[model samples]
Target: MRKRKTPDFLAQAHDPADPNPWLALYLDRSTPLPDEVKKSWLTDSSSNSRQYLLPLLRPIARGFIILIQVLKIFLPRKWSHSRLLHRVLAWGLTRFVSPEANWLILRHFHLGAQILAFIAANSPVPITTTPLEPRNIDDLKDDLFVKHDLNLFNFVIRLNQALRDAGVEMHPPARVDFSMIRDPGLRLEDMPHTRLNFLDLQSAIELFTPLYQLMLTDNDFWRAANSLQLDETIGIYAARLMGAPEHLILVNNKHPLVPMSTLRAGYRLVLHGLSTEMLHSLLMDRKAAQEQPPAEI
Candidate 1:
């Protein structure tokens, strides 16, 4: 699945301006930003390669990510570095940075790279770059990545089947409800629109956090760093910061280890049979641009 372009940072990364890390990280797409932060981030990201080399370091980056997730999961405590960051950092470093593991770390920049850098230990660093796969999370064939069936190729294919079964067409439903739920055996049409709970399509992805963790562990550091996966991850980091909209049209591009999802050309992921005009509007962000304008827009 292409990383969500909506800029949700929490599941990805926390925006600088966000006051609450947990809340900021988890906010849905369509969330508003405090203008000041947006401009700062825009400039920070595009400023220079040196300013953003964090993406080049994967082990520490994933460590930072695991740190935040662990903190969020077990918050309201002392939250010590020894107890938190160290543990997750240890895990990430062992997984991606280990020289012994075979992966394409040298080719593309993946989200795992920055995440590795962010949480990697600054002191007692390895001088020879020896292999260190964390306990119970080894890259062996019996590891979690294969155990959970979390490969991108599989994820996209499954999602494609879902879209096919839904009979997804070029146009979104004119009166489609964003929030809806179905009772056991309840037909989708039987439920009133107002009774539906808003659906965050990303929820489907969240169902497999364990799998994503496996994905985090199995990747090669340098390859992920160059792929612009961090950029995509950061874009998601930004979107999480922004929060969700009243509605959204979800798409899963299903490509992997190549380009980050949200940053790639939209045409690559637009549903196969969409009309030219509709596809153009979407890729241009023109069709939905005026949607109840931003109050400020």
Candidate 2:
């Protein structure tokens, strides 16, 4: 198990007062900004000759994502899952991608996995997905499937969270079954053979370092990634299948061209507003149902 190196920028002390220090980097203007944070704003290519071509290369990054979506359709599914290709992509990410960007990518996976595991444990119905036990970056290079699983599980968790928030009484899925996700210590070594679905194209999307690096900075990359909406809808339909179709908000794939932190803040704001409206509507319906007199047997 090769250990991943922590980025200097992320390793620095953040404002302990801020609830989410990493997120505060983009959102909270008042948050403490250290020198390392300022330095991270520079492009990875800033020190090299390629810095001159950044303007031209930067615009190409947007087109690359569109190109990949089209290209994947014509290519065989297996071609994207090649272990050698994944290793090459990992090397590019390690070398060319900024430390902050790499950290965010890995951090996104870890956070997403943890949230999904939480939802799976508390789900009223079984979320019969594979346990997303990801290895460290080096081990992941040879098996990108774990990354794909994380994305899919995250999609599930987002819906589950939304459901739980909407007055659903959630409980452990089974009386004696040990399949549900719990603390990491009890996680299965590998998912059962029947659960393996070798169709995670999200990993391929993530490994496009050539195009992604051209986004100039980690924040820019975050903007581009969010605009693409690659992983947003992964488990939505599955969530609908579980229960309360009306409770889940309709996904809005259109992301504005803005700084990633700004976009994230805006996205959350929209979700909160919508959730409040939904909750009010649900409460009214429940009140009306209760007010109705009993029907004849």
Candidate 3:
């Protein structure tokens, strides 16, 4: 009999496969900053974007900002200088200087930074990252159908089958979103916009956390984490039956853009955020049946 594989969380990266597969995005030469601005900014550790955009108003903003000492004693830290100053500066920059702030910078510079800046300038910036991230269900499909040979839906079906053979059955009433991939931008079709404006995608990813984790388990995540640490992986995997390799193999898919290892980890992390009850509902019916009802004797 083949020895069963158990997950080892710490062993996978650098030595083997790191599931995040940051290599693609990390090593990409493309940067969000414009070519001219990228060169000037990357070289300067202390490049003050405001220094260039609002030189005349900097001194006045500085004085207004110092008033933060008084605000600190009365307001939340979020409203303090470190965070609030940027907005105060932006307000002072745009209002006292630019009058109209540049949308291009506001979108690309990072939302929190821009948000504080907008608040400082007392302006409102439109949020653009939503409607761009793939839904949790779509994310699975993107992994299986777009990135790999088996469609994610089919891949999940296989996982359910493997579990059934082990005398474990996933529950009823599954929902899926299989919309034709739409680019939030005009430039890309179905592809995640090469120019997704959010400086950090985590905020967007958080929205689906509950649904993401409804399908995964702590053990599943630990295994996926291990897979990332090990280069032995071709893709990512999570199973309702923690001990089932067949189920694990079914859920994780291998593809060029999203390696099996990376997507597996991504999906697992998304699941990590889901309510454990969601996973238990699908995986625990037999266990639930065997349990005796609360007895009062």
Candidate 1 residue-wise lDDT, 35-146, digit = tens: 3233223322332322343344333434544554454455533322322323443354333231211111111112122222211211122111112222222333333222
lDDT of residue 186 for candidate 1: 15
Error of 2 at 106 (Å): 1.6
Q: Write candidate 3's Cα lDDT for 22-118 as tens digits.
A: 3233334433222322222222212232334234433433343344334445654333122232333333323222111122222222321222221
Error of 2 at 109 (Å): 1.6
Q: Which runs in model 1 stand beyond 4 Å of their true positions?
A: 1-34, 42-86, 89-155, 165-170, 176-297
TM, every model: 0.23, 0.39, 0.18
Residue-wise C-alpha lDDT for candidate 2, range 163-190, written one tens digit per residue: 6777665432433222222223321112
What lDDT score belongs to each candidate, Candidate 1 first?
Answer: 0.28, 0.39, 0.27
Candidates sorted on lDDT, descending: 2, 1, 3
**On a 0 to 1 TM-score scale, where does candidate 1 land against the true structure?**
0.23
Model 3 regions lying over 4 Å from their true place = 1-53, 72-101, 109-297
Candidate 3 achieves a global lDDT of 0.27
- Can you list the residue pairs that collide in candidate 2? none
